[model samples]
Target: MRLRVALLTVLLCAATVNAQTWTEDGDAAALLPGQTTVGSGPLTAINGTLTSGTDADLYAIYIDDPQNFSARTCGGTSIDSCLYLFDENGFGVSMSEDGCGAQSWLTSQFVAAPGLYYLTMTAWDFDPLNAGGLEIWNDAPWGVERAPDGPGAPGPLAGWGGSAGGSGGYVIALTGATYAEYGPPPPTGACCFEDGQCQVRTATGCNSLGGNYLGDDTTCTPNPCPPPLAGACCFSTGGCLELTQPMCNANGGAYQGANVPCWPSPCVEQPPGGGWSDNFDSYPQGTVLYNVGGWTGWDDNPDAAGVVDGSNYRSAPHSIAVKGAGDAIHPFTGIQGGKWVIKAWQYIPSNLSATTYFIVNSYYQHGGPYFWTVELHFNPALGVVFDSLRDPNATSALPIVYDEWVEIRVEVDFDAGWLGTVWQYYGGQLLYTGNWIQGAVGQLAIGNIDLFAPHPETVFYDDLSLQPWEPPTPPGAARPLFAGVLYGGLPTRTTDLSGFPNTNWLSGFPFEVDGAAARPDGAVFISNGGFSGKLYLAPVEGPAIWLCNLQYPAEGLAYGRGRLFGFCNFASPLGIYEINPSNGSMTLAMSTGDRRFFALDYNPVDGLLYGYTEYGSPTGLYAINIDTMQMTFIAPPIPTANSAARAMACGYNKVYLVPVYGNEGYDMYVYDLAQGVGGVWVPMTHPFPESQSTGGAAFAPGHVPGDTNCDGAVTFDDIDPFVLALGGQAAFNAELPDCYWRNADCNLDGSVTFDDIDPFVALLGQ
Candidate 1:
């Protein structure tokens, strides 16, 4: 055993020594400019260690033009020099040309196992004027002294001549010196000279001495660099422009100095309507309508049958007035040509049950005529039932007006639908609400016509304004869960029920469910098997009945920051919809798709929606710019194939995902908004242990103070079992025969440890 140990120790030392003596060689004369030799031979490793033979020292040698030595000049101009070293690859890893006029050379030592490696070299020309004249050799010292000259032989210093009287003869040399290395001199305290003088070592002294020397320490008087020239800007004549002092032409042509005293001319703010004017040529006979305080109006030539000034008419609050009337509808002219929500205020005094009315019209050059008009039928007993109309026929008239200002509003979606809501305000109190809905319309008009009365009665109108209208907030149940029914195979009999916690399950196999939406008005919408992707309506206390078969039904299912919005995806494409709790109808409102959307549980702290796709990328994580509708790539795409996102949950500002893929369990990824686009994904290290695969995850709906088991109940039976598990008297495994595993999970974290026991003790029997 002693002999074997000694042999092993000897072998180890030899191996270490052999590893330190590796060498790599290359022809430096063949190196090309800008190309770095990273690794070449099989043994030449770029970023690793190598082992080699004993008694071998590694070194590298290369050739470069002496004139190209801006990096480090070794005194002269010519093609010259070679550098060699052990461990060259370790230190010379970053070799490159120092500068334009500097030779490319590098050397460094390696602290790894030695190895023999070969490097390929290419020829490089530092001197643009002379090329292809340099030659390089390996394993040779540069500028070494040779033996004294003999017959048919010249000494190393034979062709080199020293300065007069030998003052510069070979500066300094230790004769017969072995292993002499040439490098820059040691740093001294700004006093040492190459010629060995302590003082008087300026260019003059070195020249007089005929030997190179370092310059003396003369305090450097910094020469001030010239200041940059001021910039100038030019402007054309008759143009309203501002000019600064520095930019002004001091000689003062049209360009003068600034308003300050330093340059002395000020910039002038040009007056409006000064440099240009409109040239009018003709005037036709018609009422020239113009907007006054941003209101709506009309233009018409009541006399000239063909000269209607509709082309140039402007709409405003105080623009045009109706002088002569005969049930005529004229377009509101010069209304800035934009989609507007028109509103009006009028008054009526009598409670007559006659058909009295007022009409407002919109004329679109492309889609044609559209209108919103109000009708009123009043009686002493029934009071008045007000109604609004869109595209009212010439003969259709109900009842309206008693010489009072009645408030009315008209909303028109350019390509979608039109809505008009009329309200009666009596003494600052709204008395009635009347509304009209038109699937599609174009223009707007406002006027009153006599139906049964002898002539038209004048109704005062005021406070007319055109402003954009915001859609009403959607109303729906707080949370709706649609359960799926599972059918047994081979016989197709109902065996179980599946609650699709995530929405993506709807895309798969022929699973059926009595689909329902819990309504805010205490109603529910259910669907029979008749319509594909259709839903039925039923009151919470009533029977389920079929409603309408919706197109692209999945599009009706939209999720937004903690709220869900449902509407007929195609029929009323732009209408706002909500499940009415009172009747369970998917009621349509006058509002459309112009609201900001976000996913549920969006983090205000990080400004990121927890589970919604920021934008639609295949990558499961979407960072949506809600303001811009731009979705940015967040993390790498989720690995589940053929899966769709179903539900998202948030806790501690991290978003959790419930995707619909096959048996590939619910994988969770955290939203690290801090890790911007293409950032690393942080996987949840500790997943829910009891989840076979996560179907969906959510915080318990209702709070229970001591229901540690999270089974929706709290009782004395939960305490003793939890204590027994905490005392180790019973195992809390899921398969354990007793209920300790269930009762001891007091914290509802799927575990029965100190975490579960402590919470149970605090709220015991509560």
Candidate 2:
């Protein structure tokens, strides 16, 4: 066993940045099995020569300590080669034949049971036949440190050991510790994890090597590559995102679990609902409904006509004070057709300087000079005034209670009953039901007809809405608000009223018909994305025609009284897009700061665009002013992880919402648009989760006038609710809400007032 050992410099062939300074050549036959020890040292480089595939160089080494053993072949000489390790008995231990782009390596565990190991090098194919050497190391974990040369960073120690007469930076010996605990330097292209990357490596190195190296002296332990850990995270805006848990929570999103997919969690489509709503709580008392709707003179009071006074309000925060002079006469947006129920919460001062009246200009009827008003006279002399719209010539003489909040309602028909019959309700009690008006209805104005300068009273009004009046309790979860259908089938703008009628007509596309918006022409456009994400011009009561493909899945879609708007996260810039329903085309409208919003709708009440999306810290309900693209946070974010999730609908003067629990259906929340963008979102009276899908909303068709029975007709059987109403029983008032007491006030007089006795008797005779 001749100990062939030497310490010297490596013969530089083409090692671009050569570091090996020593080497030794010993052919397999030259150092036959029994003749060993060609190289001996903890750190050494053996230079070997090969003439053919069978030619191999063998090195024998003795380990003093058990540590990880690593041997790598470095070169660019085009000699395909492999490194094999064997035990003292010549039994193979492990072998690695890796790719060599100037570097090839193999790492293995060293066991003490076989104290002696043999290292052999062979070529896969011989070409240039340049001599190569073996570099060995103790595999110290000292943080798995890499020698800045990373793959080509000058081999860790000199090619040979001190015993071979090597100088400083030479190898030393250590005892028994098999390598697994302290692995050698990793080859290039190896990965580092999120917190396990090197912290130091010159900017020049990182830039040149295509790795993140902040400075010098960086190693794999501290400046390692980031681990690829990604999944779904829910944001504060009810937006489910594909991000790491940390990124999700940091941006206000709740992590549902690990490995969650982004699409099924939702990344597109708009939910239904969005019109107008106001609780009069989100704005200053004088903040007129102008921003909410096209109205004027809300704060104008030069003549002291009116004021949005917070004091003496029936509804907290705000109510317009009518100091005579058509106070707060708001011209509501949109000319609603079909059946409309216009209702308002009002408060009249116990007494008045003269007489004030809340009127709906339903167009004059019965040959009257002005459109009729459901007049409720507070005058003790005039008595309990009711049903004035039915018989304007009548009067009452009975003392009636005043000075409290009261709701007054009226139904107007623009289709069959245009300027025809009108139904009035006082506190939900049907007061007048007949063809009462004669002209086309426009807007509403409430004030005193007798503008007496010495008047000593003011009228307070709040929560006014002209919504389609369907029965309070709809048959299903969602009652149809418009005549449009969901998108299905091919691209045709015609109605295909067939198949399953449960609102799932667009099952193939929307699968849910999730997002919806109404055109000014009363045409309904639905998408299968929220319900699908495809925008379409749908037929009323039938299937919808695909209009255009949304660039990205839209999380929210809304059609303003003037324009259509949609929220899309993948639409290039990730923002809102204005869709052309005529043809399926989209135009970029606004960016959402990369935030994912789930729903969008236009509220006719505040004339503002509102929607819900990822707040990145909380699920946020937001109102965006189109003119300034300014976003106003409406309320605190709703949590949506491991819960129902959140969905919203907008219309009338309210925003209907379903939070969390949406997966299994949850209670619906209604936010007043009058509350501006900060009012509390309260649950609606009913918990109908049926509307939790695409077309869910709060607008429904109103009862027809003259249908006192509200049975959709005026047959002889229509007298039941009226008869029950006269006696003040729950049966007759079933069609009304609490707070109403004028169901049978047929003669336009106060309840229990003597003036109604004669009229009642005459009506019974008929």
Q: What are the models' TM-scores?
A: 0.20, 0.27
lDDT of each: 0.29, 0.44
C-alpha lDDT of residue 294 in model 2: 25
How many steric overlaps does candidate 2 have?
A: 97
TM-score quality measure for candidate 2? 0.27
lDDT of 1 at 226: 27
Local distance difference test, candidate 1: 0.29
Candidate 2 local lDDT, 567-679, one digit each (tens): 76667887778876534567877777855665677765456777776555445677877778887788765433422223455644566554533324444455666776566
RMSD of each: 32.3, 30.8
